[model samples]
Target: MKQFDVERPGRAEREDRPITTTTPTHRLLPHPRDLVRFGPHDGAHRPAARVAVSVLVPLVVLATIGHVEWAPYAVFGAFASAFGRGLPRFQRLEMQLEAGLVLVACVVLGTVLAASSAPVWLLVVTIGLVAGLTSAVSDLRRWSPPGPLFFVFGLGVSAFVPATASTVAVAGVVAPASLGLALLASVAGALLPAGRRALATAEGRRWRRGPRPVDGRRTVVHAAVCLVASIAAGLLSLALSVESPYWAMVSAVVPVVGSATAGQLVRAGHRLLGTLVGVALAALLLAWHPGVAALILAFGVLQFATELLIVRNYGLALVFITPMALGMRALGGAPVDVGALVAARTADTAIGVGVVVVVLLATHRLRRPRPEAAA
Candidate 1:
């Protein structure tokens, strides 16, 4: 209700500022404390609760019906609600609708690929395209989480897992149903007294700000970068025989979301640090092998924590994200080789992050103006 932009800290205030390049040395090593610092609450609980409920309800229902295997589809659909946070009611609704449609499409597309037993090469190419297209769309729409991380995640995971015709049909129904619930949950807050007050205030009218100007060139460049990074990471991961190559692909796209080289490095650092710590946490949780109900609860709690910290500190949020992802894979009926999974996750992420760093550094050097140009 407070109209918080959880994507980037102070995004609104910084929107008009140009992205200036910084020297690599100054940007490479972020302050250690910055990695662990917590940002203001900024009403994170509201969206966190929304996303958790949106995700948990569907999982609970799937478990009740003895169809928990479909939980992945449901969870991805619910991801729609995670977008458009902290916007005015109507604008939020619009953004969520757009996001929901994209998410559902990804699930359906992934399901189809899974049912057909698409080859790994095809999966890599397809998800790379998805990443590029979604990156463009996300930038055009000014999505907070910005970039195609969720889109690639949903599509790649769906494609990697085995499925059949019946499962594809199930995904079609369950994903939309879950998406519908998420849309409702996103706006349900309007019924509350605080929400109503917020709606009546100037903050609610901010939607009248209208959309930002379209920067076609910027969008295209970013999309191309995402496409190339994903493909490179995916291919390299496969070459290394990582169990989950998509993880590398996903990691490659993370750094590209930052507005500048320095920001990119910071994001890359967060992704690596958070993931490493999260792998340890995931190992413990997988070892515990909690019951169905307990797993569902843990899923909800992790989702909540992820949303709460994600905007404040990307690295910290990843601590929960790593396990949440592994947990989802387990719920989807995948063979859980804890040792192999953990090791693969670490290796794949490292490879992905390393690739982006190299790419970024190379590009930065190329783009740097020579001394003669400065003169």
Candidate 2:
């Protein structure tokens, strides 16, 4: 894996002469239409096109997720390859971890809340707020999601827990279904071209190559900070919470550290804020329409909309992420929990962010970097 370096370039390289020997790794790939710009609304089509695409992709992909075999996966994979024909080889993978975490959290909470029967709703809520918060915090380290770490954390925790109400029927269906959807979501996140591609298309920008600019290289240090921070946040909150709050605090703070202090921190903050708001709104919606259909539509449309806004700004993505996570959690089954869940989600989000910020501050002080001159 390539990373950025901040030291001075080679003596000859700094003299403004071109480096003729560009290797395959250094070669610039053709950026998609949106990679060079921002704001998808600048496209000929409004953001509505994204929404339409989202609705269709999910229905189709999830049909596969819910399907009996791998044929759907093959067809979809082929189509995605064709669609992303010339995209970069290593597009930053974000949603993979997020979706996987959601699934893992769902499975874990399901096992907890639904052990004897389908009512581990309390655990579901706790995991949502906590894990979602953790995911957001992980961004601070600038570590993107979709890493294998989520799969381990999500699946591992649940596996070790007591097995009761997570019956064969429920486990068999829920595990496969959740795993399938996680895969579909990753494909969508990768293939959709949300960040740079979306930006380029929005501006109709093109590249006239010049210098190969450097990127952030504090990743190792940042990641270490985030991991320590997450555990600290989890422990602190666990001690503070009395009833359900105990689980909420314990489960939530890891994602912050998981991201390890790159741009992920900003996105995580956005997601955490959105989740807080979403959880509150979900409570209201639950009060009004507690049926499964209402949740399905609410989550579906919001996911589509979130993707649209996510193309423009990170804040918008969180609006939908919050609710969708809470909704997916219902896989463990529903409960009469609207108010407390939302409140706890808000609190947990705060804890995660606070922990990440503190860690970042401490780390910065410990390893102070030389200040760069302003242009």
Candidate 3:
């Protein structure tokens, strides 16, 4: 073997040599393995049970009272508490209460706008602006529901309901009913023997609360940009004569609100794929046109399944979510055009994902370079 020079660099030589550092790998999208990984099995059945009860009870009562038109209000209202499901019991309670308040405000506002007989364009603009504002608040507070999904859902669904002076009365009923039931259900879990341990843990942690690190200001900016983009995408759908522009707006919101750029990309893929499969299921359900009782049971089952699968996979959750939403809308008296709705939703989702990708690229370039200290 040839002899090699093994002398180490002198201190002066080492100091003068330019240091080469390894760059941290940051993928613009998740790896295929990341996309499929179901990292942990976190059982969410308790909260699922609560949500099913909360949603179904009010809906059943409204339908029984022949206030079927108001069922959408209660359904949307109850969804307010659907956030914070995985939190420690007391934290979940606090989070849901705050979320419920916000949901009430949003629901009431949507009702007012829908009742105003305003032009559709004005309504879209109003929703976009309100959603952006609410998203900012939600992020700053670190609320679990995150972003403007449910708020926009409430607004979009409410816009379809015939708004009158009586609508305010309906809102009063549904909003309170939703909030109260959700609170009761949320708290009820803590009374369970298993949940009691979590409640105690939360109690100990409650007073120890310190400032949680967050870039709240940056979050607000990102959420606002994302919401505005979603609105634009929704408007585009309307212009293109798509049947359900709101679905596009919702889809757009879903991706951009993800935890990371990689997460967002994964979410966009899940959204598109999930919605495609979901719409197929929805098509079959719509074709069947099941009666009220059947719809109620179906809603309950789907809601349970959605909760069960949500943590396991986003795509899986959407499969149930799509049919549940379509069923709820049909129940709320909106005409269902299964084929057109599915096509429009697919198109809108693609458009929304495109907007998110564009925003991500712009934001990436604008991000200030972090100063790296020498090792």
Candidate 4:
């Protein structure tokens, strides 16, 4: 096992350390990558485990989507399988899932007690799954913020599916199938004795460093906020546009505003410029050939190639994702106007991205001189 030469930073030096833990908070800040390295101790996944998750999760999703009548079961099957596979070695994964379920249960129970609303039911997906996924892919070997993206799934399932006696009965088949598939992969990954030992000793002294305290609630709230804001922005643009309701002018974009004031401004400026560029290019290409499938395919290929380039650069990710997103709507088998919709969508995306930046700036308001942590 090779030792990590770099020192991990303490909580105080890290940017995500709570500035005001004494008060109630709603946002969780992300940690810098220095907290973890590409080593074995923290996020060591056997290639086999990775292969299972990467393959099975998607397959389950496709199944559930195809059987839309069983959306809850389908979604549940997809996520539970993923989590069960990742949980044994990562205690945090279990903790976050349990903690999230508990918190949401309290909220649901409280609502019931209040009697201010209807006798609504509750479903819960583990937020820990999203947290674990991020942790899995992220370079941070140390702790990252906790969030139950799965909770969103739970809400969707419960709100829409109604977990009744019949639903519970159905779950008997679904839960076991989901758990059996997910947990099997994790167990196999853990059983590889050579793999486990290698992971533990892979980063000796660096392995002993303190981990970050994850703000689970913050991550959940902010992620919800971003998603909500994007949806609203998309709808608003739709209302303002000359297009009809069915042609919502490409409103399904997710904005990536800054976490700081300056970052917000930069994000806004970048998106504005990027949108203008995309629209102009789209116009020119559309002009060249109004009925060009080959051009569209070429553009699609270009968009995917650019996504690979954006791996190390988030802003670039947005650039390529934006074009590809617009392309999906543009090339869909519908009687939609290609040029006008593209222009409108580009405009709407820029506006939504601007709103995201402004909101982040207004809220986080980050400043310099916080001092560099160990990255």
Candidate 5:
């Protein structure tokens, strides 16, 4: 780590501190090099496969029992199985449980709100607030999968659920059931050798559970930006008469929250590319008009591929993610509009990416002052 001292307007002389070089300082536009940079595809195969299995089993069971409407709920619950990826067993289990509960709450609340008579603007604001809170929590927890991406996804999807007694009742039942199943899968995942390693890591951390320094201000700003951007994107989507504005909100939050402007720009590009291809794939699949069995299988495979590629590249992940989300929607008994859905997704992503970029540019200079300048 290298120490640096950049000056601030009124701050007292500060002690030497390490400055992260991975992210560039106060850039108005993305560097050209960043646009071409891509993370290596280095996801662990076994863990990803486990996540797919965890999500798949519940979805299959729900579909087989003619509860295809509950498939999305199960998917939300199984989302926890994707956590603790590279962690030891006990830690992984704890991570899964915590994340699962959060997802359950997000899904239930989003569903209830969407089903309510609340104004569309209100719904958008509420979703943004929830996303901010989730972002803060995720940062504090240092969750592996990172950020409020899934939280936003859950809220966005639930926003579409029409407010009805039957719908609410279904949400009440299916949400918890899915969460429970995810928890079980988390425990079962420990049976593998990789799980043992994660357990050992957890034990080591437990002994040293001392506080680790976190940038509260940065976290808050990140959360706030996510909230504002998501809300803005959702509103824009509504203005454009898009059926599901939440997707736009979600697309904005994901790329804009954590990384530098350059990194976000790259990610935004990846999101756009992956989504376009994914939607095309989804259209092809929709053309087949597959039954519940085919949908279930496809969901599992797509999820598996997504987990495998997500960390390496968000764009590639979206290739599978787009179809999986569409598949979930289709199976939920909702009317699938391939053309509208594809268009909405692309448009919303563009809106979100643009909002986040603008926000980052506006706020770049507001970052904490470097001690070097003060000297």
Candidate 6:
């Protein structure tokens, strides 16, 4: 049995490899240092600032207008700016446009479902389908974050929150405005002299080389994994009477996006550990009982920190992301039982991680070379 490399190729590349029953159990666990280690800065501040401004400006405006209930929709729309982080200006713009469209669609669907008061099962199925579809799309478009995590997240959170005809109309208007702002903010850097000079460099010209041809088979497999993982996590969370089942669904989708089994396990570990610590952070924040304006500012700060740390260390990013997410829910007017909320989120994340781990292991087992074939 060959040892699995931590940085091995993705599942698609390993499908034809000689497999064995004896797995490297050690590789299943991530090194402790890997969890804490941060990668190079690589100008993370630039995109971090873009995403923060995109989210902050809309939130401020909504707060000013005294329509903070619309903040969730705006936040999701601003998510569009988080894509295409390192691409050139034009490519980033194009990617953000596509992402914005997807985000807007998810928000619309979720809002409609919320207004209809759709059942839990229906929400599960709908989000699963969205996960699968968006997974394929992300792969085809070579999205940086890769997978349907944000799409499923947007749809699930929207559907979980209570909505009405009036609120739906509000979402229709607010979400798109936020998206447009995000687009402008994403490319606003181009106006700077430094941005213009960078664009003239070899790295900027690399976009002309075009994206690599997508592998349809791989895309199908990735989509299926995301769909099944999301549905399984959602159903399990519901069975356990978890308050926020979609958190489980979101966590499940995170692991499926990893490049390989070891990578998947690492991601799952990150998600679980991050959420746990984040839950504590969220609890403290909630205990403080920050005012609406204070919460909005905290949300912005957390968003900036999350974007800054995400690419470098996912687990660390979650420390900020968890609180940020809880704050967003509060802004959207979800009744906050601080104890219940944090407990449910923590439980939901654990369930999701467990589901994805089982799925990954089962798939790996099924794909392993048979004894006779090995002979």
Q: Name the best candidate (by lDDT).
A: 1
Ranking by lDDT: 1, 6, 5, 3, 2, 4
Q: lDDT score, residue 240, model 5?
A: 85
Q: Candidate 5 at residue 126, lDDT?
A: 87
How many clashing pairs does model 1 include? 1
**What's the count of clashing pairs in each model shown?**
1, 36, 0, 4, 16, 0
Q: Report the Cα lDDT for residue 347, model 3.
A: 85
lDDT of 4 by residue, 167-189 (tens): 44554454335444444443344
For model 5, where is the 10-residue window of minimal lDDT? 12-21
- Error in Å for residue 149 of model 4: 7.1
Q: lDDT of each model, Cα atoms only?
A: 0.81, 0.40, 0.67, 0.36, 0.70, 0.79
For model 3, the local distance difference test gives: 0.67
The true-versus-predicted C-alpha distance at residue 306 of model 6, in Å, is 0.5
> Mind sharing the TM-score for model 3?
0.85
Model 6 weakest lDDT span, ten residues long: 1-10
lDDT of 2 at 199: 32
Report lDDT (Cα) of residue 128, candidate 4. 21
Better of 1 and 5 by lDDT: 1
* 1 against 2, candidate with superior TM-score: 1
lDDT of 1 by residue, 1-375 (tens): 233322332443232211222324224444555556665676788889999999999999999999898888999999998877656766777888888899999999999999998889889999999999999998888876678989999998889878999989999999999999998998787778766776676656455436567667567766887898899999999998988789999999887864456667777888999999999999999888877788899999999999988777888889998998987767755568899889999999998899888877766544333567457
Question: Which regions of candidate 6 are displaced past 4 Å?
Answer: 1-33, 199-209, 332-335, 365-375
Residue by residue across 1-375, what tens digits does model 6's lDDT show? 111111112321221211111224324544555556655665677778889999999999999988898888999999999887766766677888898899999998999999998898999999999999999998888776778989999999899988998878988988899999999987676667766765676654344326477657567777888899999999999999998788899999887764446556767788999989999999999888888899999988999999988777778789998998987767755577999888899999999999988887766543333467457
**Per-residue lDDT for 204-225 in model 5, tens only?**
2342223557767767877887
User: Candidate 5: lDDT over CA atoms?
Assistant: 0.70
lDDT of 3 by residue, 243-297 (tens): 6566677777776554345666666777788888898898899888887778888
Give a tens-digit lDDT track for model 2, residues 244-350: 33223333333232212333344345546556667776666667754454555665576556545543554555666566545544423446466666766677667
